[model samples]
Target: MMVANEDVQVAPTRGRPATLSADGIVDVALKLLDAHPKDELSMAKIARELSVSPPALYRYFPTRTSLLNAMSAAVFADFPEMPADRSWREQLLAWQNDVAAVYERHHGVMMLMGWDDQLAGPWLKVQMPVLTLLHSIGFSRLSLVETTSWFLAATVGLIRTYLAADSDGLSRSDLIEFSEGLGGLTDAQRMLVEETREWISRGDPARILNLGFEALVDGVERRLGSLQAKGHI
Candidate 1:
């Protein structure tokens, strides 16, 4: 199952053909997941799709969990890194854009984020620097742990808000329908959602990410000052 070009702006024009080996089995599984959810996928299904017996697959994956672990490791193994000298906000904006670009380029890879330990561990290791960067910049004004949590919510919140949006991003009209149908939003609340949606739709998704991330950092700056003044950092 190739990633549809329409779904991701960066989906590759072609894929490397896999030979029926350990890497090959994992590669095919990754492709197959583009169409099916994780729970619905199994080695037997993969074997059938590959026109090989299930036992033949054992030479590669050994077990389903191991295959997933391998997949997780592969996704993060060569993920990009930021340069050493940029300011914190610049580095973080780059970090957010980098992850978004990675997900767009690899297609279904981000879905593995919900998998168990094997998937979670390596993924976090790759992305942890973003959190550490925030902590380093915020310093005593914000506890590293709490600041990291807020950063996660802010970044992930922005990503999740429109990750499903396509190349053009979401439209104000789309959000209008949602706001109207999903009643109980006061006019002020509805207006806020509409404005946020419009801001997101203004350009490529990276623009929305930048705006949201900067707003988050600005809020952090404010809170940090308040905490310091109150002797609570």
Candidate 2:
């Protein structure tokens, strides 16, 4: 179930100034992330930046890991609401592109997405919409779960790779050239390099995400069809 916008409220802290809400803390953290890479942004640093005592920061975050988990949830919440009229593939691509943009804007959060604890809250909110899409497309319950899991993994993996590469300040063209220079390239490898260059030149994240997502969807659909033909669905 996609969380209703009303249900996504940050817990209100008592006795704090109106400006000292969790949302305000997340805003500060995002600014810090934009200024520093993931490994460099610390809870102490955020506290110092906000001019709050470290213990005061603990009143909200409790620990560095908890703070990071909150940050990850914030990232997911920042995604633009999906368009209702788009196809499932289109919706998924849009969602992935939105996530990629957020990761690009706050490169620090990319590192946290890999940790299971950090990802839990966002995953709960994410999987339902994806599962609903799969169900609408005629996927069985078990297959819907499996396929959505794979899609999330792939989308996050791609975003992680993209952010890590961006942090190094390597242009997309540079990455393509580097990939092409590797020895023993298979035809598929060359094609990927070419496609990557095109995607980069166009500055089209949607195209890149959609291409990868569509391939995954195609595989899932084919498998589902086969299973259904065998009376599995």
Candidate 3:
């Protein structure tokens, strides 16, 4: 997961306001991400939002990729520093929650996190902190690395799935209509759907994410116990 600070704006100061800095550009870009979807975000659109010419943005970002990298960095800037005193499970849960919140706020970036070179720095920075916590909790170095990777991949995949499921453009109504025509599901099935939808309406992503993390940790603890019993360490 790409973790960064909330987008910070270039503040107007006593001196002439700084020309569009990387920070300024990222601030506008984040706004644009919220205003528009990932498919719609563009350098030209960001320049327009910032009230600057495209060339002016180029002086700071150089290319669209560079701007994206900056935006990715800014997203991670808000991540809470890893706590030294917390138990490893507590630390991991906190980190996962923080990443999930970041992904929710910048849902557009979920798409980029899987592909962008911009994520590399934050990924590297976070890896050791996470591994150290896992190791401290009795994970072997290899186990720590593998577990961390699995957890991250699973969380990111879940976020992407959640976003895709909630997207308005997909039209769940159409699916219902199609199913109705096919006599696909009985009335009982349709009613179950209504109940499920109602439950979903009240569900919070943060709560759901925490629940998932707990389940994962439970499973890992069981396996770790087995490994220790076998004297694998």
CA lDDT, every model vs. true structure: 0.61, 0.64, 0.63
lDDT of 1: 0.61
lDDT of 3 by residue, 111-194 (tens): 344344535465456556766776777878777667777777776666556545235332222234333443677799878866
lDDT of 3: 0.63
Question: Taking the candidates one at a time, how many backbone clashes does each contain?
Answer: 0, 0, 8
**Where does candidate 2 stray beyond 4 Å?**
1-21, 38-40, 111-118, 163-206
How good is model 1 by TM-score? 0.68
Residue 54 lDDT in model 2?
Answer: 55
Error of 2 at 220 (Å): 2.8
**Poorest 10 consecutive residues by lDDT, candidate 2:** 1-10
RMSD of 1: 8.6
Ranking by lDDT: 2, 3, 1
The digit string of per-residue lDDT tens for model 2 on 174-233 reads: 344555475678889877867777656566654565676677667667877887899877
Q: Candidate 2 — number of clashing residue pairs? A: 0
**Candidate 2: residue pairs that collide:** none
Better of 2 and 3 by lDDT: 2
Per-prediction TM-score to the true structure, in the order listed: 0.68, 0.67, 0.72
